[model samples]
Target: MLSRRAALRFGAVAIGATAAAAGAAGCSSADDDRAAEPDPLLTALDAARRDADAAAAAAAVTPDRAGALAVIAAERTAHADALATEIARAAGEDPTLPSATTSAAATSAAPITPPTIDALRSMLAESQRGAAALARSLDGYRAGLTGSISAAVGAQQAVLLR
Candidate 1:
């Protein structure tokens, strides 16, 4: 006669085996479907570019804040470049080529109004939030890069801009 403990162990093992089989069978299609979804990093890259553009524009119109805005612009630009390189690498493309983000930004015809210091502050806060969230979802170097970017943006918003 089967013991209660032994039966429970057998059942658990059977269930686990069944689950593993199902997971393995589903993995290929899931991977293919996931490939169709856009990478979250692209959004982050675009935000960085926009923030850099905004900061540069703000600096141009608000001379008093140019010093701080220039720093923000340079940092954000660097962030954008890093993100673009990562995105390209992940896509198995040549990092030397201009990324979609860069091309789009360059061809963009929309005129941007120079923002006030308050507006720049708000934008930086938003960018920091997005970067922090993206950092949470990523791992490895991508995670560290975004985490660093978020921290820098936080400092910019809290200390530099203040």
Candidate 2:
């Protein structure tokens, strides 16, 4: 009774509506299981913190830029510490205990390269991407703490980029 295009569109909409109803009825998708796993977002933050530290160390800068980099690095380190503390708090562990596992990413002692503004630009770009990712991760973790961290990283990127 319907044209071919209209029939296809109707079928697509019907499928989508069915999927939406299933989702609203507490259906489980792969994405829904993300929160059940050990938080990958924490691992990502750990990696980003290391990268921020590396960037600060590698940046060839004047005194002003040096000061800014120092602040940025300190902020990043503080962010890592805060994340560790919050995670520990959630698990009823003493957050003060320095867990070696916190920084357990397998990274190399390789040197940072191309000591120039180009390098700085690259790091800034990377940091911005990390910030955006962290922001998106708010849904995967505790909204309060994760959102705060995302905002902090985003603000840091803005300052550093300027």
Candidate 3:
């Protein structure tokens, strides 16, 4: 009884309506599921990274101490990058930390003739505390990561102190 054109239009309309309904249902039930709260471990890691970055920037690295400075800076930067990625993945968002270039610039700048021991010590303490906090708060693989980082920071402290 319907014209050919009318039937084709009706079929297209039906398909469109079905698709829209399916999409709405899926979004309402599934896609809406998201993390209600940000992970505290992520927050701790981010804080530690920021402090490490600032400490590296403040420390006085002379020509003789370049090697130690580089090592310290590199480790902190690497941890930060890894943490940022993990945090973003957990939250389903892009990374929120400073980009690598800006972070590296602080370490690359000329330091005082001799290294600042006090500043380095402060930085190490901050890093260690951050790691410890994360270790205490998280478990499983996250606990391992924080515990390892805390130990590593302690070792770095020894190296700086020596």
Full-model lDDT, candidate 1: 0.88
lDDT of candidate 3 vs native? 0.67
TM-score per model over all chains:
0.78, 0.55, 0.58
Ranking by lDDT: 1, 3, 2
Superposed Cα deviation of residue 33, candidate 3 (Å):
10
lDDT at 154 for candidate 2?
62
Which numbered prediction scores highest in TM-score against the true structure? Answer: 1
Model 2 gets an lDDT of: 0.62
lDDT of 2 by residue, 1-162 (tens): 899999999999999999998887674555466547776456646645665666577544445477767676677677677777766665556878755446453243355553444555565556556656655756544555556655655675567646
lDDT of 1 by residue, 1-162 (tens): 999999999999999999999998899688778678887888888889889989999999888888989999999999999998888888767889987756877798366788888888999899999999999999999999999999999999987799
Worst 10 residues of 2 by lDDT: 105-114
Error at 151, model 3, angstroms: 1.0
Q: Each prediction's Cα lDDT score?
A: 0.88, 0.62, 0.67
RMSD for each of the candidates: 8.3, 13.3, 6.9
Best of the two (2, 3) by lDDT: 3
Of candidate 1, the 10-residue stretch with the lowest lDDT total is: 101-110
50: Cα error in model 3, Å: 2.8
Winner of 1 and 3 under lDDT: 1
Instruction: Report residue 22 deviation for candidate 1 (angstroms).
Output: 16
TM-score: model 1 vs. ground truth: 0.78
